[model samples]
Target: MSKVSETTLEIDLRALEHNFRYLKSKLGAETKLLAVVKAFAYGSDMVSVSKKLEGLGVDYFAVAYVKEGVLLRDAGIRTPILVLHPQAVNFDTLIERFLEPSLYSPRILKEFLKVAEAKNQKKYPVHIKFNTGLNRLGFWENDVDWILKHLNGTNAIKIKSIFSHLAASEDENEKDFSLKQIKSFKKSSSELAEKIGYQPIRHMLNTSGILNYTEAQFEMVRSGIGLYGYANDAQIDSELKPVASLKSIISQIHKIEPNESVGYNRAYKSDGYRVIATLPLGHADGIGRHYGGGNTMVLLNGKLVPIIGNVCMDMIMIDVTGADCKEGDEVIIFGGNHSAEDFANSAQTISYEILTAISQRVTRKIKE
Candidate 1:
């Protein structure tokens, strides 16, 4: 990999492959792997990430919206794509692109059926999303009867899989709750399979669930953060390599005298002599304002430096006082030893937020 010349997000494809294989080792031999590549592959260039995953032999791909699936299709991704949240308005385009939709509600089911029937789609693949405990977008267990009734005479669409989400698979304190959710999903999916006279693939594990609940591996498993190299657990995180490395070069260096204010609203007032280094990326580049005022620390020349003053729209200043660093020095916002999880922890957030918050404007350099 080349040294950081500017603010760039370096995506290591080898690290992604390592993470994928690591997560796969946790599943049964026959269990399928569905890679979630929504939100620009969690803010690291969705098209590139999806391409690599497809090459890695991922069984399926999942996205949050119809457009995301379309993007994969446009990129020549041939793997089956499941749209996790399909709106009624995009049913036509979704089917047109052969993107599978996760039908979570009666209205959405009916709307998709109408589109499928109108388009003369026979046995168009679709997944049924059940709300085991997430209380999010999914059909209730009671909705099974209604779903069966609606599908009694339809040949336009077919259920490809029945799945649910685990609320707290990463928290040991919530182990009982996770188990109950898993049990509920099993019961509901079994009931639906018996009534529907067919068994669709059953899956209900995310990245954390994959790590903590191997028994509930069902027929398939979905992984998002795990592929990006995070398991929400410190011990597990050590086993996975982060694929995205946020790196920037010091744009400039300044010497602040005593009582000298820096940045907007005079957020940082130097008490004595200090050295501050300005980085090109700021709030607009996905480093939010909340990370300002010394809340977040960045690595400069192998030393951790707190971000001083308010984050500018396109720049941020970090205290580099007494550091053996100069202008053009590389700064690691998060990656390698200090993972995105570590970075987000400093701001009372999670790896998901920081990873996905990275702006698309940041140059993405794929490390093959």
Candidate 2:
């Protein structure tokens, strides 16, 4: 193991196991589970996370890019990996890597089918993504017939699954809209399955949908955040052990007399005789400018300290007056009293953004 840096992201693998077990309990014995490991497994060491999931007998893994899936496979992750957004250019590499692709459009489907046939890839798994509600990637209901017709004579690839995304599964306000999307996704999947002469593993629920709409989890569910020890309910953050704890040591501490300013732009003035601790992390490392000027707090000695002005690219200063912390003491940016949602709320964003926004430079430690 490398020496622990002054700043590091600690990932609790046991907490991941607990979250997986909890999620497994929520689904019936018949329900299949596909763990989504896209975005470097949400910026927390994909190889470690995916290996643990594979050992736990997870049914499959899904990544955002074909290259991401290939990395997992190269790392000896034997679980079936679904590449959610396979571009046409990487289709050959995807096939060479034995990675499954989510064909989002008819053009992609036709191109992938041709490649599969050239390689004599018989019964290779492929999923069809429907744009039921997300309006992002996926085929429309009207294009289903066109999709099936385009591949009328191809035995190169098999329809392994059909899935859709829930746009607002976590919000109760959009129940009607959510239900409509669910209904539409089911209808489209069933129609295509009939045309293909076999039932594809029909899945349409993301992490939020899996929590709220149990009935819509057809044959499988793709979950990301829930696997990382977070729930849609922000109030329950305390119960869910956060998998990533970003901690930095107080690189230095300074005693500021009254009327003294701190950081660039002198955003915060010392009101009285006070102590300030500088963290060796900043916006360039994903803390961002929005967290500047007392918008957020960092934890010191298990107590909260408001971050003073202008988060620089390499460091941030925190007011630690009246605290028992000293130079080289550990400070938490999030993952203790401050959860991902808590930070996001302060920054006027969502948990997903914060979780995936961590810079790659921060060393990640996988806790055994």
Best by lDDT: 1
RMSD of each: 0.8, 1.9
Q: Alpha carbon lDDT of residue 11, candidate 2?
A: 91
lDDT of 2 by residue, 43-72 (tens): 788999999998898998999998898899
Give one digit per residue, the lDDT tens place, for model 1 in 277-339: 999999999999888889788988788999988999999999999899988989999999978
The alpha-carbon deviation from the true structure for residue 129 of candidate 2, after best TM-score superposition, in angstroms, is 0.5
User: Candidate 2: what lDDT?
Assistant: 0.86
Worst 10 residues of 1 by lDDT: 1-10
Clashing pairs in 1: none
| TM-scores, one per candidate | 0.99, 0.96
Local lDDT at 180 for model 1: 96
The model with the greatest TM-score is 1
Give candidate 1 misplaced runs (Cα > 4 Å).
none
